[model samples]
Target chain A: MTTSPIADALRLPAGPVDLTAIETDAKPGFDGKKADGKGALFAMGDELADLQERLWAQRTVGSERRVLLVLQGMDTSGKGGVLRHTIGLVDPQGVRITSFKAPTDEERAHDFLWRIDKGLPPAGYIGVFDRSHYEDVLIARVHDLAEPAEIHRRYGAINDFEARLADSGVAIIKCMLHVGADEQKSRLAARLDNPDKHWKYNPGDLDERASWPAYREAYEIALERTNTDVAPWYVVPADKKWFRNLAVAQLLLDTLRELDPQWPVADFDVEAEKKRLAEESPVQ
Target chain B: MTTSPIADALRLPAGPVDLTAIETDAKPGFDGKKADGKGALFAMGDELADLQERLWAQRTVGSERRVLLVLQGMDTSGKGGVLRHTIGLVDPQGVRITSFKAPTDEERAHDFLWRIDKGLPPAGYIGVFDRSHYEDVLIARVHDLAEPAEIHRRYGAINDFEARLADSGVAIIKCMLHVGADEQKSRLAARLDNPDKHWKYNPGDLDERASWPAYREAYEIALERTNTDVAPWYVVPADKKWFRNLAVAQLLLDTLRELDPQWPVADFDVEAEKKRLAEESPVQ
Candidate 1:
């Protein structure tokens, strides 16, 4: 597993995680400007594609290995952008992406992880969660949706759940797209200006924006508590959309390379199949 | 919808559909060579991306309208390739792809369309079925997996099912990727030759290849029986991978243009929300 400097720089350190200390607009490890970042992301496509296919091919041999990307962020932090730019590099057939929304009555009835379990990638898939179980703590804490005791307990429950997933060969990459309040204001205004983007805007977003400080505190607490070895969080500086995409793409490529999934060898005799095809099934 | 000459030429006409009569390698309705074909398919990307977004946005307003592309082809006919090259053009978020393998015990216990119902795309999404319910007729007829009486009944059942989907706002584009015998042999041989592709090879594919005549006859019968006014089948010549991808992309583009999903209007007062963001939510 080759090391990536960006992954190291962005990976949350063990102890308290402060969102204010992280530079939201700075490109920490990437050197070039926007065009170069775009080119770099696109360049990673081939290797990323190859690794994804290899991982997908593991299913043919009944291997249970897979990768899951959990994306958590405030609205307008470009979680959707990462999905389009980063995860889009690979074949969609090999991908299983689930964007979690507000819970339905059926979902709210069960433990939070119940719906999460249903969305997990089967063997050999690269699964992505747009907003994940982390929301149970972030939003639940910020809005006091759940009891204080329940919300506190969810942090440990999430770590245990992710640990079990890792034991079963699911490599989890958790990203917190950390955008500043000022950057988010501009993004929301832009969404309002463009009719094409209005569908993405929710009036309720203003209510959330009003609670930025609370959300930040909620996020810091969630990150510090749930940052486990099995699924550590990476706080991405997301004020620059291009850099955010590039950083996430690099993170995905690094994880896939570390997994180093091999193309499965033929289970049957190759030579015999070749001869049989030539002799018996010669196209009529 | 803009007229696509390819769609006109490929659309299975009313009457008996004969797979043998179509030229597998011909690039009908395309004026250019291979490089031009690739360029054209890539150029379609921007428009495809925009149309997909608009279709996806429709869900914000509770629109059930969506598009479903059904790909039915023999092994090595490039169903996976179409998924990678053609369907891969849109954001994977809006596209729900289901590659139907053999039914599980539960799936087998129910009627064939039962599983298909579970795979339908929700509001504001584009769904692709790598292989779909057509298999119930094609594979069922080829191997006599079902009784002749049951196989005959399935054709009508399929048409009824599709008509119901169309009524519920599914714009269906069913494509039958048509590859010839020599082409199939070469493709299967190529799979055998590449060690990296060994995982894709199955000895059972050879058994299906041996029954080429049976599968072709089954396909012809199924195509003829299930071709509906609401959901038409287009026989895509699959010997040339580029042309197959180009044709399917054009078919999809044309369908989306016809749907002409408008960007949903903001349900909230935009100016009020903008003011609220600027005033009440001024960056903490």
Candidate 2:
């Protein structure tokens, strides 16, 4: 798929961003590839692997740098694809992933952050939240998880929560996988049409579709309120799955590269240890 | 680095076997090749990328296949190396890792299973526990997490808990990294000798060393009690880092391949979607 040159040039806001501008500027069909035919997925994969290694090493050496990746998106927005591709590049030990479903009674008993806090990555670990704390502001606001006034309050609370986590040495990267309405409808239809994927289809998704404008408005407001310098949101173009993954992976790699942890030297004498092993052998 | 031919030819048991016999009989060294020969470190970098992709795919489809990787070991058993290598092969999106640290007040409040249950992988996810529920039996019996009688109960509970999770479709792979006492002493000494790693050196670890025979007894009991057909434990040789990683990775990949989830197909009309995209593009 091809995106317009103008749309292609649009850079996602790095820190606090104007939600209206972000929404408007984020064209749905923006092609991740230019005429060069180079897709971002492969590049991102390579970089992600490198970053994961560096991060894993840091953890091994007792450096407590934690990273929280928040992925928020509309249906068919390539969240899954991006997640799949990005994780493909990292060490499994240093990473954790959590996907939030409807709030169970136990979850609803606690404040919104309760379940989330439990899922946070340990020091020097990476935690990926498929849908995260932002759900309070997004779905809750749309479905009335709270009063409108309370929803407004959640925005600030979430911002503070993420900022505090960032201040405590956690790197937060929030990606809003942006897709077009047409794309969402088609993808939703695909779910309905396929026998194997029927499990993923929900009648309520279409009900939400009728209120797309409201959800979009809620998303814009949430983005406006929560986007911070310490914990920023990236409005990634998600029409292309490969590009989305590549972009997120690159972003992750770039962030870790900035951390720049050094590999610690192994303290053992290799030759001496080998000799000791040989001497200890019964046959030897 | 290579094992004797006689040792290589020996057949090992697939079920519960003596660690000493396996160590003596099996070929030494990891069969898994590093992605690149910057030693294990560089190979780890490459493997992370591959893992990320697989994880992302799992997450995208919302598949319920969860991976529970258990890393168990004695002190200085190269658990760190195994972790480094394993993490090097996964994507952060669908992967979650929890290292069982010393218990806290909150942990003590719950049954041994509670803390572990909180860390269990969601459907279509991968979860790694550095030291796991088995600790209830291993350390509990070794250091006495409970009374000797209570330890017996916990053993059954641990086994049942794992059996239930496996029945619920969790693919559990447990590795008991084996290292010689002399090798361990050398590693512990290395930690003390290196100023940078001094923080990791606890004098208490030496106290544990004094009770090595007791701990081994505890390990034997724990293995006998908990090694069910569903969650079989592999007593991995840890002296050779490369061989250990290869064995573990192969086991994991083989398990995942066995599950064999089909990739989500593109359900839209590819030609139409492409043509629509092209027609909509001004430049195209």
Candidate 3:
């Protein structure tokens, strides 16, 4: 039951990833329509909260294990929406979200992974990267921010880095939200249509949209290059926002269930403590 | 309608404050029972989400305003419960929650406020401190960690620090979750009884419980000394967990409604961008 078909279907296969071949609007593993999808997600909330607490409780037993969710997508791919609707289901205290914008000068001065290393979740926490070190490859390759050799080297470096994280007990979930060009245009236009959404629209999103083809190729290159067993990639069909949220959430749920974090046993003498409370700590 | 009677009723008045005089189980500003209280909190979710987004959107327009909610209380006073139930209502992205534990060597090396300054929310965010700078006075006083004069000086230092934060547009909400000693005994007993909750129990909590009177005196003195116009303290009767959650959520809602953040106006031409998107960026 922990095995989600969505995870199996949406997971990028070992050989190559073609951004064009996947139908952007297709609901890959879900059988029903929108309402059912939402209801299914809603039903998972209690279990999600339970599993997250168990994961968080592991820290008390000196477990360093944590989950880092890396979300990468083109503009208007609904990363924020997923964060609010999906990750928002759990207690915010147990979740740490870091949204990476353009690197600050201090960040640029360090290795691309340095800032990311700093943002990693602590023991018993779920760390989310809205955009992450993958940017070092995706945007770096697209904008030619680094030399060709350096850009080429980042792929290996990322793999090695994630491998170390895996060894040290980090469950990495990498998602590439795959929205079609038409979908992107409409989402951007909707930002223009609504005053409440204008804050989310950036003119630079247009620049990124114009280079959609390049970005797709860059993603394909990055995804194919760094798709390791430790941190595999999921190409969520982002044209449908609900499906994107549900898939990511289901992916997280599946992972948590697999981890199967158990509540830590009491280190103290529970019976003795209970006795002490009864005797020494009477109602005041 | 924007104002909450809960905020006004819970807010500690300007004068000598007495923790013992307050009833820990009484529901102030709320006439309903637990189910109705939970219903009221659930009803506030949409407004909370909307207001949080407005506050978050302010960052787009270069607004520096943010709100900081500092929760301080004895063990099992339900600070964690409030965080899970109340602050959990809004988008976690817009919130920055810091749980202040015993100071590290590095944290202790720096001025007390240095670590606190580092934890402050960035512009346009709601920052929550499960335990905060007030620990300097409360714990320092109880354990005699600092000189008598040094502890006295910290009150002024904290007031000045908050005044500066207020001047820079940080609306501060400090809540002291006042749970009675008898209720705390039962809660501690419950933690000892449940294996699932054992991770949350620390044997040291019993030691702290033994020093309850000292801690209460410390809180009383700390509240009296540092409570200011810039950052007032609200004594939330936390014996009823539902009321505690609802009251704090309402306080946040009241503050957000007062700020009444508007969605940022787009700096770019909406019509022109729509045209460019439609013409240049067609479906692939």
Candidate 4:
């Protein structure tokens, strides 16, 4: 069966998705969902594994092209799930994941990019950032972490920072995992109720929930200002975890396929090396 | 079955290991083979995963404690395999991986720790470094990446740096994956002969192989000097990939088990929250 437009847009394989399109008072107004595509999702997962291995093999040649996947989202928006499921499918050797947290005393002493610049993946490697530099715009704006005037400058600084990264041969894929406030509340409450998940509950989460509208506005501004072609942000409907994973994986594959990397051929004598191996073996 | 003492020391699971002990004219060595008590090796891996999950759960409560695992070894040492297998066992939500490469112009402008400090795992998280600050003492000392005088200073700098990290509540685990030169040659030759593996063969690797004695000397000095009580270095026999994975995992598990973190109980009025959920139900 052919995939529908929404399926293709979400990068889900040919299958049904159990989802509902809902409207919110937020500026974007609505989000769409498809039926569950678990089968195709797992199949695409396998394909992602193969693609990752191929990319890893290419990396062995020490090429100078890099890939960076940045994940931005509200709490409980499935960013962690997407990262876990997708990276699970790649060769760990060629993949690196960096999760940015609140700045420490030493980190605050330097410019914001100081920490980010060091975490860039090496050439021919895949780097995933869970909550990246956009925090400067989102949290800083919402929580008033920085002066209001300084926050305005950070918007421009972030745009230039990402533009420079894109120009430097890094294919940047920024994903904004979008989940409704109600969905987030459900997930957060679930964590509180479950004994095994009790560790994942915090009073501060409720406080953040109180400022959801403000954070949403901040997110919109951040996306509009910094979403350039080089590192455009894809606002993903993340209420459906499976679909989100499939979408991000497809995006990664589409990007890597565009690179069309080849396994560099060996210049040395393979036969001689094999012969040497045989000579050293007792079986001979 | 109970594990053997050496197997226990190496942290191998209950399985056959392809043990090979090597002895040069000056020194004797061992190879990969089945050993008794290998199960103990896996104990650490399990402990690490438990610790990681606890840390991840703590993030919701805003408790930050960073855990850094640093793996260093010679070529053909099982660093890749250990990383792949151990990380696979952890909850990806709370973990990040950073692989250090040759510094770019921007990175070179800062202190050696600058790049690494940026990649530190956020509090309540685990970070794995494929190769780490030890590169200053290993590669820099081996290839003269920095001046001779600078190399000596870096060793002390690294010690002080790691101590500072420990003081700041970052538990550090440093492992040296050990493999003999002969085994390295064998693995390198294997990569050269297999067309599927040809991409992994770098001609420059041969040059590094030629400097095996120097690298070994540098590593020995590094292990002797920088390994402290806060961050002791374990010389793991990495000729066997399975044993290496099991041992590293066990070490991580042991360290994490010691922390024994518990999930924070939510203090919110659960009955009120449940009432709210009911009141907010769509049917209502």
Model no. 1, DockQ: 0.80
The per-residue C-alpha lDDT of model 2 at residue A6 equals 29
lDDT of each: 0.91, 0.65, 0.91, 0.70
What's each prediction's clash count?
0, 25, 0, 42
Q: Mind giving the per-residue lDDT tens digits that candidate 3 earns over A70-179?
A: 99999888899999999999999999999998999999999999999999999899899999999988888889999999998999999999999999999999999888
Candidate 1 global lDDT: 0.91
Q: What tens-digit string does per-residue lDDT give for candidate 1 at B8-121?
A: 988889889778888999988888999999999999999999999999999889899999999999988899999999988889899899989889999999999999999999
Candidate 2 lDDT by residue in tens digits, A131-195: 88888888888887789888877888888888789888788878887776766766766765555
Per-residue lDDT of B1-284 in model 2, one digit per residue for the tens?
13222123321335454555556213344333444223544444454444434444555556567788888887777666666566555555556667788788999888888999988977766677888877777777777669988888887898889899988879887777777666677776676665555545555666576667777777767777677778876667666566666666655665566566554554445445434433442210
Show where candidate 3 strays beyond 4 Å. A281-284, B281-283
- The C-alpha TM-scores of every prediction are 0.99, 0.70, 0.98, 0.70
Per-residue lDDT of model 1, residues A125-204, tens digit only:
99999998988998998888899999989988999999999999999999999998899889989999998899999988
C-alpha DockQ of every model: 0.80, 0.18, 0.74, 0.26
- Regions more than 4 Å wrong, model 1: none
lDDT of 3 by residue, B15-101 (tens): 788899999998899989999999999999999999999999998889999999999999999999998999989998999999999
Top candidate (DockQ): 1
Interface RMSD for each predicted structure: 1.2, 8.5, 1.5, 5.1
